[model samples]
Target: MNILHFFFGVCGNATALFLFLAPTVTFKRILKNKSTQQFSGIPYVMTLLNCLLSCWYGLPFVSPNNILVATINGTGAAIETVYVLMFLMFAPRREKVKIGGLFVFVLAVFSAVVLISLLALHGHPRKLFCGFAATIFSIIMYGSPLSIMRMVIKTKSVEYMPFLLSLFVFLCGTSWFIYGLIGRDPFVAVPNGFGCGLGALQLILYFIYYDKNKKTTDDNAIEMGPEKNPHQAQDQAQAQVKRSDKGSQNGRV
Candidate 1:
């Protein structure tokens, strides 16, 4: 492996770890309130899936010399699992059923990938298949912020989109993208390239609305209603982040 690739890979690992842990503050609040309130469990659930697929894709037998990808994603999988489990523990019954069902679906898909790759595929074919899975999910991981992005636009507030997380997303994605470029691995490069662009866009959106958000910060602090449909509640929760404001986290991996 090229030393520079290794260096960037390490950088990616560090930043990715931060990305995984960023939700701790939000999870802390769920614990404190003894309820998930309006928080949606989907991001954590989906992140768990991305981490699983990425980890598998990075294994030596699957892709070779990508241990850094495996290490960080494996750790992320553990962290996200805890967050999802915690969300389940505190979320309302209806919310529990929804997230639980998604969790099962994630497991089923992951199992299918593993079984098909190990049993039916080999060599470059296995690598390609695993890489395809990782890439698709990684792209989905970046796209997870769509709901939050919409909320930022509609409310004219960047309150839910923390500047620091956006910053880290850019930094981490850039590092991984570079690592993938140097290593000649499109699987890692393509999705992170997408992430880098989205991260940049998010930062731009935050700045564009920051001043406006300040003027209506009080009004924008809309409380969740019990009658909110699951979709609406999840939408609000998607815009639920910006941990710098004391832990109101929402989208992204």
Candidate 2:
């Protein structure tokens, strides 16, 4: 059982690390294009907050400090900071201002939470408080894809939703859920359970809509073919008449 827990912990940390770095592709594209496009900084900001909270929850003061949790989430916090900074650099003026303000607000809230936890709570109380806060934030992070799902349904397309990311998220959630359950950490388990569900749903929606969109596009092309062919034939006939008239005049000459 201890071995199993260790395996799951390592796997969970690796998958979570991948999840944190997934946005690198998006940021790379933004840098190449020199535009933030329509990408929002909210997700990265929230992810950073989630990492910070998780790090706090897994601190050495806890009965059994989850070094794996702390290490991966700490790295996540640093990576997310880079992502957010790049976003601010390339984002439009309005977006820069808005995201900057949001970043500051989040920092203030995080500081207050840490201070209150440290000053008011002790030992297990502090651990529970931080754990609960981390759990809530993790759940929010899992549900962050809801907006993208809504857009997928509305547009009948999944262009903005990457299936690879969804798959990895599902895998990450499953690993963490197993680790949490075996380790008797409901705070970690519950949110990851929800994360698994949401990730699976996103993948399902992607497949359904991807096929639908492809079929729709094929049907539209087929429908346009007959309309286009008749116009093309008429133009050819007109050109043939002009050639015939020119031949007749040349014969007369």
Candidate 3:
């Protein structure tokens, strides 16, 4: 069991590393375009907070036998920082200010957690407090794709959701979940269990919609961006109906 625990931890580390670094592709695009486009930087900022909390929770004093948790999350924190900085660099003025303020808030929150954990908590109490903080943020990070999932169902398409990203979500979540259970740490287990479930749902969605439509991924798909126009869907549907009507008229003539 001990060996198995370590094995999963290693697996978890690898997958989580991929998850942390997965945004590299997006960042590269941002750099090439010399713009952040409409991409939101909130996820990266929140993820950095999650990583910091997890790192603190995984400490030897806070939680024993979980050095792997700290190892991976610590690396994640560094990576997310870079991503956040990049967002600030290329984002438009409005976006730059938004991300800037959020970054400051993350630092403040993390500082509070650190202070309380060190001064007010000890032993199991410290673990529970730190673990809870980590768990909440981790779950937020996992569920960040909720908007994308909604878009998939509404459009009946999986084109916007990348297959590799969904696969890694499942892999990373399952590995950490198993590692946590074997080590008897619910902090790691619960949030990851949620993530694993979400990942499975996404993959199921991808398969269900895969190849079902020969049209482009954006065909009939609702706008999934943060600033979608509410009337866009109705306009798209009306346009589709008009096209059908025109086609029928031409066929008859």
- Tens digits of per-residue lDDT for model 1, 67-164: 99999999999998998899889989999999999999999999999999999999999999999999998999888776667766776666556777
Candidate 3 backbone collisions, by pair = none
- Model 3 Cα lDDT, one tens digit per residue, 1-253: 9999999999999998888877777777779999886667888899999999999899899999999999999999999999899889999999899899999999999999999999998888999999999999999989888877776677665656667778889999999999999999999999999999999998999888777445434422222122222245435545665897899999999
The total number of steric clashes, by the backbone 3 Å criterion, in model 2 comes to 0
lDDT of 1 at 1: 56
lDDT of 2 by residue, 120-217 (tens): 98888888888888899899888887766766676555545666677888898999898889889887789999998888998898788885424322
Task: List TM-scores for all candidates, in order.
Answer: 0.84, 0.80, 0.87
Off by over 4 Å in 2: 212-253
What TM-score does prediction 2 earn? 0.80
> TM-score for model 3?
0.87
**Root mean square deviation (Cα) for candidate 1:** 8.5
- For candidate 1, what is the TM-score? 0.84
Candidate 3: segments with Cα more than 4 A from true spot: 212-253
On TM-score, the stronger of 2 and 3 is: 3
Question: Which predicted model would earn the best lDDT?
Answer: 3
